[model samples]
Target: MASEAAATGSTNTGILGWIERSGNKLPDPVFLFFWLIGILIVISVIASLAGWAVQHPTELTEAGEPVVIAATSLLAAENIQRLWVDMPTTFTHFHPLGYVLVVMLGAGVAERAGLFGTAMRAGVRNAPTALLTPIVVLVGMLGNLAADAAYVVLIPLAGIIFHAAGRHPIAGIAASFAGVSGGFSANLLPGQLDALLFGITEASVETVFGDWTANIAGNWYFIAAMTFVFLPVIWFVTDRMIEPRLGKWNAEAAGNAMAEEQGDRPLTDGERMGLRWAGLAVLFVIGLWLLFTFGPGTPLIDEEATPEARLTPFYRSLVAGFFLLFLLAGWAYGKAAGVINDHRDLVKMMAGAMEDLAYYLVLAFAAAHFVAMFAWSNLGLVLAVNGADFLSSSGLPAWALLAAIILVSGLLNLFVGSASAKWALLAPVLVPMLMLLGISPEMATAAYRVGDSATNIITPLMVYFPLILIFCQRWQKDFGLGSLAATMLPYSIGLMLVGLALTIGWVALDLPLGPGASVFQEIPGTVNPVAPAAAQ
Candidate 1:
């Protein structure tokens, strides 16, 4: 293993091994949030005593001077009272909670109905040997729409497909894993993650710009572009760096990777019919949305609003749109596939989806309190002000500041695995601070996605890392955790660099992040603070 890792110019015995060890020592993410809240209370009390404050950017006095904003003690009578009284509201009103649950209600149906699985099989079923790597990577990226389907279905199947094609099974597994986990955030269309992250972004935005509501698809265009940027990187790493180092697979030596009956079968006639039905369902949903947008009422299109504001309604509707799209398509597919018999069965699938979110609900409870308390203490705003001031004074170019955010998110991803949990902790500080420094919430969220996705493959702490390792060991009994990490390291490093460059270039070009979403947000009270690229 050491020789193989050395040959590939990767390492798992030193800093990376230490990272894996230390990361495991951390508490459960749920308990970690609770601990953070306890720590936040202490910080709030001290900051209040020290008179930590900043001038409110929007709030002003009768004379038109900026109001001096100060930190409030979480232990104060009013704050403690609100905490106890508002506990229910705090948990219930956590924005990401509803967004995630609703999306999953529909998605779970799709995954169970076999739509996601069959779609993946169809995509890579007949790929030519020459284009197999890119095809696998692309399918892996698209398979992210199903969340678990990519990891559980497509990745292992890639190994079989490779073996049958007379290629190294591990290389196929590596490429698929890279595309699925390493390119976690890159997708052609906004899905559950978009709803979850942007919901949190909206919540974070309220602390700084109270009137600014985030569109669920706020980072749509940017993430779509990431799909292209990452596809090639995963392809390059898998073919050039990873495959060259992995010796040929020995079919005789490798144990059966899966049960004899478990190898991917050609889609059944019923499944193919289900797929056709699902396709029709998707088209119907898209057409319905188009009609709603362009028809006489133009409910989704605001005629009275500014050009940039016109599509806000359409963007917001995407949450519901995704729900209906997945629900109807899954139901259609299930009906044809004989997986669902009646409306009662449909209801069961939705319930099953909610059942899957049980852990997320617990995590959201801890995160909600942390976010709410951070806002109530006034520290969220104060930190943003102070951080923005320091960042501004540092004279780091705006593009560089955005790049720094990507690096911070990527580094933190090594220890914290849940995307929402990390973003919940980060968005409060990173989003508001960057917004105060004249970066858009869209841009900040986009940068976080890039960084968060790139490092997922190398980290052992990622929830799926062990599962992936198990998959690899099925083919090669000697495959260990370090071997898996070493296999993915090149993909991690390559994606990070490409994603960083993409982010920097996006900011430098001042491109729109999504519908009406720009790289810079103009604060009402001040000139745009983003420093020019050449000025750096």
Candidate 2:
């Protein structure tokens, strides 16, 4: 039945059709952002009636005022009046947005300077066929720390490198996609994401207990463990499952060849020389950072403080500072190499950068509205507290709770694709509830991260779902959303299992997530017996 449908092709009609047809057509992020907002508004209307009507039974009847006007006015009112008036105050309360933008500014320069593209090409350019699979996957996974840049650079590059090595390009795309989007949370080096999550966690925890802190490494150990676990699974799945099905490409495939001629011409002689200088510049910056982080009387690190202080605001700033450092190095390199002839060219690079982010912008806008609406309704908080109560009452083992959370997270991901948005909604309730159950905020956050990251590649709501469709179209000219989904289902299942296993193991081990972060024992007498609870 499936093959018959594939042969005639009615597969691209619904969600799958949306995925297949939209491949690289619209900017993804923008589209997702808007869609999420629209959905949130719909949900908000429903929630407002459900919540408000439940609270004020008499308001269900119309007074002298028109019913619609009265309901609309009432719904328009704010839950927290202070927060409603002080947009900047509430906005700043969600500090992750700033950190993300700050880092992107510097990253934007590195990419504009051709540093990232050059490095990727240099890394994968003449690699052996046997090692190509793992190398591509590893590179893709590591690329997550740099934000969404990997999708534009690595995915297509994998096809080129694989084709050059006399292998199927689809195999390359599959392998790289697995690493970048699939293994997004599995970075060995903690990046801006860690800091962002920690900030949210810290804030959420504080709402429950008077004083609480979440560490930068809140999800580190779990992510690191997944790094090793993902490598072999990606390799085997790409080689055995995806590649064999793809066979070889035809003349149509030649059109999508990954060539540097269109972007910036292969690094010029001057650029190579500039790279040497840039390399030295990077070293200098690293030396300075080390001195500040460890040297006596250095402001970057507070010498009198404990390990957590050494990492908190200091490391957070350091992560943002990386973007600036990269930008500086790239600008110097571009100037030295003569690639950046003038300010106009530099602006063009950044402009071109914006073109790629069109989709992301769309997704963000919708996602922002969706998240805002979701928060406005207060359903997430209510549901989380209720769920936590049930879980806590069940007397289930921690491992079982962790597994259940992972499963629910993966399932929820199918509907809501934005990681930060989902977590923001989840954290305020789950974190604190779990904390009361002897699960640290760090552990709960870690479990949530694993579940969230594991299923991203399979979920059509993922902004880049369309991008993966484009990748599939190269080999299977008939490839659409269903094709992409079918191809990725195995990897999703594999990663889900691996992610859950690692999470369970971590809970069992009771390891520290990062400095001063732990898996067990929330502060005693933390929960308010009257109120359900806030998240960790």
Candidate 3:
């Protein structure tokens, strides 16, 4: 007994040593993202001043149609001048600080009020060890519907739960991280990210197919199918492959105590009532949203109306709705739970939520500015046209093109963590090009989603990567980018393979990608010359 006790002490000390070392090696998340953003701005300014981006359009419109408008860059001072100012502003415009803060307000309420923790405990506690991998993966995948909360809460809790379960907590951390980040697009629900991507797809598809509509559910089934495929692959790799290689965790490295969570007060009578009311409030809010979205003549649904007349864009921008639902739910819960006694508590909750997001705000401001500049420079469009021509002339198979797309998207994810931003950059090119080949835009969107999601866990560019690293430090102490990369590599490969395989399966089945979007079709008014491209 004495020997065993001594060994345990030594082991714990080793673990703590590892964690401390890892923390020292890794760059701070806030600082890293901020630096990258700053660097991008500097490069954009240099290019603008160097006058290297000058390209005049040979023809502004094709076939007397308004479909193609090339930027006359470098050739005109007016073009370069506009690009200089507008480029950085793009990044700022989309990552709305106020919107992010408002959304976090609702999120903070649920987190602070014990709802998130309670739910997490309930989930991990009930899951059997054998089912743990799939369960963790599924939970993380589903959590995407809630936006960034998975990073904000789930990742750390996963480490704690694993430690309590008498297992290597880093394995647990990797599994959850895999599901949450790598499987981001695999959620059953079409959340804000989907809407953003679909909007870009719709706009791009319109160049070839005027009536193109990228529904929110465009990638739903593809994502769902990948979800199941990924779960087992993650389970097998993490349990049999990754964990075995990882060995035992040191004792001192047992991770943060589960004790802080232990004495948390149970829901009081008033709080219970508040929870019920909050649940109803949530239901009521969702009901109203559904009514507006699905109801006939409801402005939110667009009722077969024109772009201005349609509700598509309105429904697509559901982040505001997400903010409202949580706000009302949090308010009601706080009221019943007695945690919120007055308007002051409400204000405090919102303030607390906004405060933690300061780092994200800084990063987002720079990113937004960069994206704005990129768009203004028209480089993205020009690059897309040239790339599309190359792909077309190569006469490659659809599978080959898709495989290339997946690889390209995965590589791009290493630099750009925001899914929407990447899709925005890629969609305008991929969607229209794919349409010309007789491939549906929906399929293109699905392919992009798979690639974007697969690499998120391993990418330092992801906004949440540092947060995940910090969570890991609480358990292993030695964990760093290499550690995280090593641990997550298996899950990443699994998701990528399974996701890509499922995509190929969908194409083989000749299934509908979404409403009015199919994998293959004949080009309009052309029977002999089949449109060789697939709609992305």
Best by TM-score: 1
Q: Which digits, one per residue and each the tens of the lDDT, describe model 1 over residues 1-536? A: 33333333234568777887789789999999999999999999988887777777777799987777778999999999989999999999889988888889889999888889988998987899999999999999989999988898899899888877878888999999998988888889889889999888988988766866768787888888998999998888888888889977677755454534346678889989999999999999999999999988999998899987899899878888999999999999999999999999989888988988899999999999999999988888888877887888899988898788889999999999989989999999988888877888999899999889989998888888877777777788677778888899989999999999999999889988888889997864542232212333
Candidate 1 regions with alpha-carbon error over 4 angstroms? 1-13, 254-261, 527-536
* Model 2, span 374-484: residue lDDT tens: 455554444444455577678899988878888898877776777876776577667766766778888888888888877888766687776666655645667666767
lDDT of each: 0.86, 0.66, 0.64
User: How does model 2 fare in lDDT?
Assistant: 0.66
lDDT of 3 at 271: 58
Residue 30 Cα positional deviation in candidate 2, in Å, after optimal superposition: 9.8
Between prediction 1 and prediction 3, the one with superior TM-score is: 1
Q: Please write out the lDDT profile of model 3 over residues 1-536, one tens digit for every residue.
A: 22322232233334433543444354554454456445545654554444333122222245543234233233246645765766555444353444455556776776565554444444555578767767877888877755666766666666665666677777887888888888888876655566557656655544333455456666666777777887888788878988888887665654245525432233357756766777898898888787777776565765576754366655454656667777788778777777788888888877877777676666555545444444444544444444555666789867677777888998777766667657755776676566555667778888898899898886654667666776666565556655666678777888888877887778777777654446775533221121212211
Q: State residue 128's C-alpha deviation in candidate 2, in Å.
A: 1.5
